[model samples]
Target: RPSRPASRRDDALYRKADFPWYGLDAAYTGPRWLMQAAVAGDGAVEHGSLGHGEEPSVRTEGGADKER
Candidate 1:
């Protein structure tokens, strides 16, 4: 089978905005397993959830919550 093309939404959004921005949502992927692993490793995956609290509290970098 052939691979799908990457979505242009992130690129477009970044270009449209001038400031340095970061995504607070889960990473995009074609496979369900990839998505599951990402969320499992990182608690701040934001899978249909608004998250626990404010920005600083939830804006952790990669799987920090799992450690704690």
Candidate 2:
């Protein structure tokens, strides 16, 4: 446990932000510094944004909203 205790880490093991210029709500694969994968499970929402910018887009297997 951290010295300050883990609020989210205990809940979902997701680390806090301020780790980088941009980070996500959680740290799964890598550091939460890139645009979110656009999925559920308390993941980051935007890229290079201060929580005020647009969210990252994820392509569905159905190809309804495929990425360019």
Candidate 3:
């Protein structure tokens, strides 16, 4: 079967990015931050939300959750 075309709603903005940290402080941290901001459910800290000013809550490795 042929693949269906993606709609505007299926854009990258609607996708999620994963961040894998190997160590406490790594060079890839920069990229991880970028990816998180790009597709993070809570949205970017600078942008303060993509469509809404309210951002979602994000869980941290410290067993705590924070809002973006």
Top model number, TM-score: 1
Give the C-alpha miss distance for residue 49 in model 2, angstroms.
Answer: 15
Better of 1 and 2 by lDDT: 2
TM-score of each: 0.21, 0.15, 0.18
Q: Which ten residues in a row have the lowest lDDT in candidate 3?
A: 28-37
Q: Rate the local accuracy (lDDT) of all candidates.
A: 0.29, 0.33, 0.31
Tell me the tens digit of each residue's lDDT in model 2 across 1-68: 12222245332322333234433344433322232222236754222322223334653555466678
Lowest summed lDDT window (length 10), candidate 1: 30-39
Residue 41 error, candidate 1, Å: 35
Q: Clash pairs of candidate 2? A: none
Write model 1 residue lDDT over 17-62, tens digit each, in one string: 3333333434433221111111224333323211122224343468
Model 3 C-alpha lDDT per residue in residues 1-68, reported as the tens digit of each score: 00123244433332432333223243322222212223335652322122222233664566556778
- At residue 41, candidate 1 shows an lDDT of 40
Assess candidate 2 and give its lDDT: 0.33
- Rank all candidate structures by their lDDT, best first, as comma-separated numbers: 2, 3, 1
